[model samples]
Target: MKINPKNGVDQLVFGMKQNHVENLYGTPDKQFKDEDGNVIYLYNKEKLRLTFYEDEALRLGYIITSNSEATLLDQKVIGKNIVEIKTELPFKSWEQEDFDSTENHFNESNWLILQSEFDVIIRVEIGAIINDNDEFDWKFKA
Candidate 1:
């Protein structure tokens, strides 16, 4: 399935299925049964995660990496439930002390939707990578 660059998260979730997801990302590293007897597939690579619940994709995570650590680029919710996203990175940075901490260096944007009494939130962040560049050359949908 083709992903709409303007709304990549939505396109991903809508296009995902058991066969399509596995074909694109390959077989999951681990698989197990949940309490409800549904199968859950987990793939934890350096910068990618494709999780499936009950043979349906529940979440997809893609990480963007720099010289240091990697930051998640895309996260999509597929189930009929609410989910929360979080990061352990602090909110402040001490540039004066050469600490270059994540605190105060994180930048975030989000898209939220409420449909059929279910809420979905897509959080996008640039992390420390944004501070290193004076300008960005992203091309959005026209």
Candidate 2:
């Protein structure tokens, strides 16, 4: 499935309500709030976690996947190193951050974030695009 940056994964867009997603994905294995109070819907079978922003009526904020079969720009990303992932820089640029030695690289232009462990990408996330007002871009609404 193509990860549409600032839009969503496949047909699921950013401003879609939880019920809309549930209609397509069925019930999540678990639904709860995160430390920051963002609603989270976990699908253990798919190894996917979806985050929703509280300010936007719980519309999807981002998608996190550890699925080994997932690909970015038609290239396998999970388990690949930064050097490998950069073989073709899909975005213009990205900013790197470190947490407890774990590396996180994010590009605001495309809203993609990669979390790496031991130099290997352990997870990939695509988030909602924020507008000039610092709000989720509801343009992708269903």
Candidate 3:
């Protein structure tokens, strides 16, 4: 899968509706609501989880993949260590989570986040970028 920072992963652009997603990937292996009530659709075999905003719009707000084949900026990041990812992506200007030193999640201004566990990347996620006013600026409006 291809990752586009602040936009989407592959063809799943931000703000797409449920039907659009279903059309592209078929039904999810499992579907449930997260703690915040957002809808989460998990594709077990792909190790992909898509989160949709809860409202009349029900737009896709997040894309996450644990697939080892996923790539970002032409660099394969899954299963790589933080140091390797930083070097490959040349992860400049990424803001590290300061709340806990043990946490290895790093987020850029664009909202492309690399989540690591024990120094190894376990997940790659892309979502809408926060605007200057601190509001989500969705790339698509469908």
Candidate 4:
């Protein structure tokens, strides 16, 4: 499914209440707080993470996952190679960071900061993605 700001990433979006999410997906497998004070709901079995803001109401902040349905620009990203993703998404510009592949982790891992028309910064990891507000300073930090 195409990622929509109103509909949210995959199944949830910002401004959605925590209870509404619980009702839709049932209780999360586990929950934890991130260093940024966001509440992260982890469904390990599904490889999904729903993060909520630190407000008392717990509004959805972002969604991080490797779910097959969590797509951007019509690309079915889960399990897809980075090359395939690069082909499907029309990223205006990007910043890439490479990770050293070790003996224990032989796969070549990298991070791509995909800047899109949606005005969101998509952090594309080797096997997962983190979609959040574009706090990237386009003029200075890019």
Candidate 1, 37: how far from true, in Å?
Answer: 2.7
Q: Return the candidate ranking by lDDT, descending.
A: 2, 3, 4, 1
TM-score of each: 0.31, 0.89, 0.86, 0.61
| Candidate 1 C-alpha lDDT tens digits along 1-142 | 2222222232234224556557666787776766754444554652333333333233222211111122223333222232232233222221211123212122232222211122322222221111236432222211
Once fitted onto the true fold, the runs of candidate 1 whose alpha carbons sit more than 4 angstroms away are 1-15, 46-51, 55-142
Q: Quickly count the clashes in candidate 2.
A: 0
User: How many clashes in each candidate?
Assistant: 5, 0, 0, 0
Which pairs in model 4 have colliding backbones?
none
Tens digits of per-residue lDDT, candidate 2, 83-139, equal 678657668688999999788998889889889989999988988887899867775
After superposition, candidate 2 runs with Cα above 4 Å error: none
- Alpha carbon lDDT of residue 141, candidate 3? 59
Model 1 residue-pair collision total:
5
lDDT on C-alpha atoms for all candidate structures: 0.31, 0.82, 0.80, 0.51
Best by lDDT: 2
Tell me the deviation in Å of residue 89 in model 2. Answer: 2.3
| lDDT, residue 49, model 3 | 93
Candidate 1 or 2, higher TM-score?
A: 2
Clashing pairs in 3: none
Q: Using TM-score as the measure, name the better of candidate 1 and candidate 4.
A: 4
